[model samples]
Target: MSKYWSEAIQSLTPYVPGEQPKGSNIIKLNTNENPFPPSPMVLEAIHQFDTDRLRLYPDPDASALKLSLAEHFNVKANQVFVGNGSDEVLAHTFMAFFRQPQPLLMPDISYSFYDVYCNLYGIEAKHIPLQDNFCIVLDDYAQANGGIIFANPNAPTGRALTLEKIEALLQRNTETVVVVDEAYVDFGAQTAINLVDKYPNLLVIQTLSKSRSLAGMRVGFAIGSAELIEGLERVKNSFNSYPLDMLAQATAIAAIKDNDYFVETTQQIITMREWTNQQLQSLGFKIIPSKTNFVFASHRYIEAAELMGFLRTNQILVRHFSRPGINNHLRITIGTEAEMQAMIDCLKRHPDIISL
Candidate 1:
């Protein structure tokens, strides 16, 4: 409310990220972070970073890291764009391609950041409602506007839109850009990156945070036609030439190149997710069919708020949204087997209040 603040800054509503509680013993499943440690190669890369090289400015374009990503995804270096994180990549995408005469369309319940980005960029947003089961219905989006973007394994609900459906949307919305935020794709969803070669307007954004277990490193990227990447580069160059530092560049390349580690960790998470879903259901929680790394569920008998509080008291934290319609559901991240066991044990000890 200060007069000195600019209108944009004053009016802006920032996105709230998940809590990263500071402690050694907290069983943190609140944020959808990978429970496994990153590969030893990534650690070695960071540990071996040269202090003397810190004085020199990092490559403004992050060429080496781009090359590694290009090779990993089998795309041309020019077709990919790197950023501080997927959020930054998304921010650039909204500014460069999404802003237009017609409003951008997204799922009503989505990565909360989408609305914040719309507000920040002053782009009008039309939130299309999900189906009764919380799945994205492609037919409703046919009368769309400027652009379309949504997570593949749609967030919160953890339901995924198939690659075939994604292709259908791109075919219809040829003129407008279609961004697929694939932050959780590696968990189960098939990537739309396979379609980028055919559809020039299709842009797929991904992050090293979830699958690669590099959330601490803050590296994310987008794959599309060269022209789309150029638009993001223009926005990035206009803002910060060196969005990625030297150590981040080195570590990111290492993370992407460690194929064995990436496969093992993601597969483990997927297995754990299936186990968790079965366990939760056995305890009377109606779990959403999830293809992502987390599960969204609500117990038939217990109140969502009360369950969340009980979990917190037991020091097992999971995400509980305060937003309408989803207030009763909890978004629980799939941690290690032992962590899941501990959570189950805690739940077993508690009474079924709704039954009482």
Candidate 2:
């Protein structure tokens, strides 16, 4: 709160990321990160990267990485845009296509970052509420705005919308850009990348952090028509020419190329998520039908904050938001089998909490 601060900086409320506990004894399921290691190829690529290249700048366009992603997603090289992470890519997106006279349209219960980006860019936003079951109702978006954006398997809820519904929205609204954030699409949801070719107004954003297990490397990308890609490039180059460094470029390329390892790890998480959901349900929790790497559940009698505190005291951490309509729910990331068993054991030890 200093006079030296700019107007935007003074008015901003930045996004709050999940806690990263600093101990080996804690079962960390607060952040929805993959419990498995990144691809072996990614490790080898990092080890082989020449530290001598740090003196020079990385390729501004990230050409090699873009070409590799193009081949993998069946899109042309010109249609791909890479950035530091999906957050940066999304920041560039809000600046590029979403800053319009009409307010941007989004689901009320979608990713919290959408609102943050809107505020940072001075773009007005109109939040469309989700249905009673926490699923997005596409009809609400038919009225319109500057652009539309929502996570596929929506954040904190883990419920996914069908491709038919997404395509239907695109078909009806061809005037403005529609950005589909697919950060967790690899878990069990279908990707909108398949429809990017058919819908010129569609821009699909994805990250290697979740399913590919490269959160530390920080790489994400966007796939859209060449025109939209060029728009993102204009915003990116205007802000920072060299967002992706040499190591990040190499790591992303390797991670995208290893399709077998990616599939194996993603399937393992999905299996674990299902098993965890069943365990929670057996203890009188109402679990949402999740397609992402985490589960959203609410107990029949216990308060979510109390349950969250109880888990944390037992060295297990899950996420709980204080917002209305979902304050009673907990978002638990799917950890390893042993970590999950440990969490269940903690719950069993506190039967009073579950029976409250």
Q: Please give, for residues 1-356, the per-residue lDDT of candidate 2 as tens digits.
A: 88999878899999999998777888999999999999999999999999999899999999999999999999999999999999999999999999999999999998899999999999999999999899899889988589999999999899999999999999999999999999999999999998988899999999999999999988999999999999999999899999999999999999999999999999999999989988898887899999999999998888899889999999899999999999999999999999888987787777675454
lDDT of each: 0.92, 0.93
TM-scores, all candidates, are 0.98, 0.98
True-vs-predicted CA distance for residue 23, candidate 1, Å: 2.3
In candidate 2, which residue pairs get closer than 3 Å at backbone N, Cα or C atoms, i.e. clash?
A: none
Per-prediction backbone clash count: 0, 0
lDDT of 1 by residue, 1-356 (tens): 78898788888999888788897788999889999998989999988989899999999999999999999999999999999999999999999998899999999998999999999999999999998789998778898589998988899899998989998888888889999999999999899998999999999999999999999989999999999999999999999999999988999999998999999999999999999999999888999899888999999888888888999999999999999989999999999999999988888877884343
Cα lDDT of candidate 1 equals: 0.92
Candidate 2 is scored at a TM of 0.98
